[model samples]
Target: MNKFLAASVSPALYATKANARIFTLSSTEHNIEVGNWKIDSTQLGIIDSFFSIEQKILHGGKQEGSKIIILTSPNGLTITLSPTRGMSIMNVTGQDIRFGWDSPVKEVVNPTFINLESRNGAGWLEGFNEMMVRCGFEWAGHPGIENGEMRTLHGKAGNTPASKVEIEISEIAPYEIKIRGLIKESTFKKADLQTVAEICYIPDTYSFTIHDRLTNHSDYPRDYQIMYHSNFSKPLLEKDAQFVAPIKEISPFNDYAHKGLQDWATYLEPTKDFDEMVFNIVPFAKNDGSTLAALHNKDGSKGVTIEFNIQELPYLTLWKNTDTEKQGYVTGIEPGTNYAYATSIEREQGRIRQIESEQTVHFKIKYSALMNKEAVDKAKKAVADIQGAQKTTFVHTPIAKE
Candidate 1:
């Protein structure tokens, strides 16, 4: 028998608006396995008689005034999606563990316009520090002018609010809850991009899945780029936290990163004037054709694992920002269509991907927050296999082709 299963602790009780019973399982080390549902509001209209899964709309604070759609499962998985802000995953919690990070700003709302001045500018940095932010359609890095037009930091996708947002709760196998959302991103005379995001959760299970499909509804050939800027903070990213991944090669993105190549996996405490380090990773594919990476807490008691379809997102970027105690201390586990480099440079390197006129493409990423020792060991072993199979080498230069 699995040690985690054998050591099943008592079940905790949680209340919901409908007064439902949710049994949450945990271990001796305060490692919660499942979560209970507790929410009651009139904003959540009933779609069906299936009360096991709840879907509701939460109006943000009066300051931001953003509207959010929240989906809660019988288990302890909760997902918050902001339709007004391009349907980004604002916050995700599994058994009370924060799977994403929080910005210095209290209210998370989309900016009016994209700031295309510098890398860590004011406006872009506001939305850039969320849970899972989509980074591109045209560019995915520092602000620069390409083709004599100003390009914003990351891209405009994060600021482009979704027009039409839909939600549905259904069933899938043993999982009674399947939430599907469709968000539309289009410009008047420029481009149109549509995303159908799905989240599936099973009762008593500690993991969930996210699947996204982005379609191009334009007539002319369009250049597209997307990066899942998955940020993590706090308990999951302790001072001595470790990052593990099945990396085939590591390319430094800056001088600071090149200098810290020897100790890239280990995180440090937040300092006053610490420099940021960035690395472009070429992940090794497994027999299942998927690649994975994880961030484990100091004691290895808990961690967050990210799995992506290597066929679609062939590259990954690791952003280590232990810069300041106030505005820093978060890491990014990003999987994207291309490396997070300047659009001009990536295009010159033939890394920019183009879609045919009126064509579509799909991308998927899965986030799992594990609590048991067994799960952590398995993750470590998977990363170890990749390290053992290949010799990991680092490039000590700026982020570009020599």
Candidate 2:
């Protein structure tokens, strides 16, 4: 790799320079738009040519005008990100393995067609097919009336488009790539929050990290909640798949989930009209406040793990919807500051978090894929180590009073 000082150049200038290290795809503040473009190592003067980035716009029903960024890494890892949909991960594939689910919502519907207030505030489901989508920057959970306001499902962070998008690559050996986006959720006199979301990917690795920083730009204290809804299906998820984690305490979200308490960490085969089940968990962390969770296949030959800091995301929720394949059989491993309860109920339960005016909060999580049994075993051992000598407490009934 060539060693040069990192610099940003205008789109027109970058197109003519073979050594440009940064490119801006869209910027509202700068009034710049270089839509549908592609860049590779050759364009950046890198010795290796295994990395590439491409941006394209979808044209069709509900998906028309939506933009997507596809990233191909040297380690055979390909990730698709939707800039038109809050920069969420559309899907990820490594070698022959994939890390996303097949949802009934086939199209990546742009936010323009979503009516978040329709169907009693449940309109967020129309465009809910990403492998990993963010929920909340303000309030996240079930749709209901809270404090005279009709709170929509999972908030608006996932549906909100990025105001700016950029791609940057290091100019040295073992080059690192970062795809950054800026998303703002604000109101004139109510709330003002800005999120800087970045997906960092390194060469020769089957893992990626989501680094995000959220700031309150208002003049008064603000209440907020955020959850990483990472969903998975097939290959790594099946009739005998298991969810492993170092649990401190676990409880059913409601009566429906209570009936499946005995097999909370286990999954069943896809069945017709299967009711979804959810479990709230307080995970056990290591001395450094780091914890991890994994989902392994039946024979433990393949798996995936999510690693994060327990101090940043103190709660976890497991959602199992093993309905028919056509109905979108999937599971979600979510980590958040609070459980998935209505905003009003979470406030009463003292689960909603608050930030002072002009305060900023940072969060990061690593998602890795395990392609073989050895890797799967290693991930399971790490979770077991965190659980050493710790007993898990299971609550038999629903903990939240709806």
Candidate 3:
């Protein structure tokens, strides 16, 4: 058994016949590899259910050698996760609505083919198609030199492959399905960080949750930053698609973004050769410190929502890239400890986070598909309630110093 699983799962639970099922797909320490495997409800003695998980490796092109896990829920939702790509979520489909973008770089390019230092440090864009990808365990932001060290775009968290991958399914009512991956980002005499990424969902739900725990394994305290880059495209994102959030404060990312400041909460039709705009935001939260952001289609009939604890993720970034479909039209609802700027700039602004040796930080985000007008309306009202009568402070210019 993997060490992580042994520590998480109770021995008595596995001792019972109706407890849960655990499958280890890959583990370097245990020398375990179950290539091209699958398990369904029938195998688990589950009655009349559609829950299943399949693991396989892709072949050919830049995607060759990439490991993908396809999960089918009982509620007609299908998710594709790439463990080889730092456990990033590749695609999500529910009720004929896809929760991912149409990027020109279609393949799930393996990290082996991605040279983060190439193209002047913008090579991360080559494998930038995931619906949700992590940025940073060390540094995350624009490509630049920070304290004489070259930092690439968004850091290397998303490109670092998982060292262990496993699946667990509860036998109790609700029967939660969990896909966990352990990723290690380490270097000698520098940084040693480990992230345990888990994606969990009930058997019959249109929603899923991401729970990640990042630990500092070094003997000394280290500074770090992390961000969840959640991207979406049509049919949830389209012309007139509104980005609804409980905004307390907001600002344009730069001068170009200022041009679209007035329409920051709305989206436009896909335009040819469109320049992307970014906004930095501080959101209003509920009493429990939980907040949500939603993207609804033009008619409000379909949408998606992301929920997180504002105390853990204090900053939000809205990325609007409504370019032509051929150019990969998309928008990103990013949550992070800091905004997306050069790490040096973030450090100067005192936004970077730090962890003591052997300490861990936890992050959780819930994503749900809104399939009806009522669901969309409810989500919008929730944001509105959080906003209440508070006026939003809109900055005419960017906030961070460059």
Candidate 4:
């Protein structure tokens, strides 16, 4: 019943991409006041190579500062892994963020490597951005889980495919775009990232795969990982930063926090005082532990709600790098598929769900950028209004998931 303005009244006025569904967006209407910080895309406008992505605005090219980039879809599939907090969405006064396999979207470092390292000028990664960037997250690189009977395990990354993706810019709601990518069970390495692949006939499901080659070629097992390494602007986060999640328990980052491993959802500024930022295995305080993730800020402006559903993934990671100086100034609320492998431990012990090799997973994540008390009230009212329209299983309040 959350009255998420999924469809905007704003009209689309751009070129379309063949057969696609366009959604609405009021994102372009805001008047922004960008600061002295000018964002120049290295891959595009900036004279210097900015190690960014090739971007083409779908609408409203007349905004002020280029800090946010908002994306929408019918199904809940937008950002992944280290998703942007107030970041992305070409906002006027939200936050700055980065993206990609190994590097960040805002050019925190060069666009080379994922989980691995490539030293050099790319080390420009030092400084404020480094402290704010998400790092050291991991995941299975191919579709489904890999099981082992004796020695060898799941198939290599190249077992699935990449051709399943289908992108379309809308003709009707041309402002919103649609991307319908799938995994027809072909190649694995092609789908490195955990992108939800379309499965025809099924109600709600996502298939993902991976494909990577370990260059050293040591006669051994190859461990793989792929998560969108996101880093956010720390200065913008209030002053006294803290994280919140809905989880009952959390694996503290090297056992760091207020006292011991309390509920994983709430975070306090580590006593060791990391140079940058990191909220270890955080979650939302009230979400029934059904989801994972949390949002922290300085001076405590209420708090943002970030959740990771079990459909697309299961694990959530929190990396705290607070010992360095200078750029080491931020923290991360990392989300993942296997909770540092501890989730698996719980599952095997019958505390959580377990998956056999080659099993498909599916879940939906709902992101509501609730502003102070105002936004929370709006959402509550929305849930109330839903009962007025169509009969819901529950009443007005957010019912706990059974």
The candidates, ranked best first by TM-score, are 3, 2, 1, 4
Off by over 4 Å in 4: 1-166, 173-175, 179-238, 253-293, 296-303, 320-325, 341-360, 376-402
Better of 1 and 4 by lDDT: 1
- For candidate 3, the 10 contiguous residues with the lowest summed lDDT are 7-16
- Is 1 or 3 the stronger prediction by lDDT? 3
How many clashes in each candidate? 1, 0, 0, 59
The residue ranges of model 1 lying beyond 4 angstroms of the native Cα positions read 1-63, 113-122, 171-173, 176-181, 386-388
Decoy 3 TM-score against native: 0.96
The sequence of per-residue lDDT tens digits that candidate 3 reaches over residues 251-313 is 998898999999898998999978999999999999999999999999999999999998889
Per-residue lDDT tens digits for candidate 1, residues 1-402, read 612123323443222212222222222244533322333322234333222433233345522445565666535666776655666777877664777765675565545533535453325776555788888865676666688876667877667655433332222234244444445556777667666555655545667677776677778767778888888887788788999998888888876688888889998977667777889888887777687899998988888889887788888999988877577678999998888777888888777888776676878777887776688888888778756767766666665842
Cα TM-score per model: 0.80, 0.95, 0.96, 0.43
Error of 1 at 256 (Å): 1.7
> Of the candidates numbered 1 and 4, which has the greater TM-score value?
1
**391 Cα displacement, candidate 4 (Å):** 31
Candidate 1 has its poorest 10 consecutive residues by lDDT at 17-26
Please give, for residues 1-402, the per-residue lDDT of candidate 2 as tens digits.
211112234546232133325677887776767888998876778876468999998899999999999998857689999989999999999886788999999998999999999989999999999999999988898888987999999999999999888887776767778887888999998889988888998866889999998999999999999999999998888998999999999999999999999999889999897899999999999999999999988999988999999888999999999999999899999999988888998899898999899899999999999989999999999999999999999998898866
lDDT of each: 0.67, 0.88, 0.89, 0.29
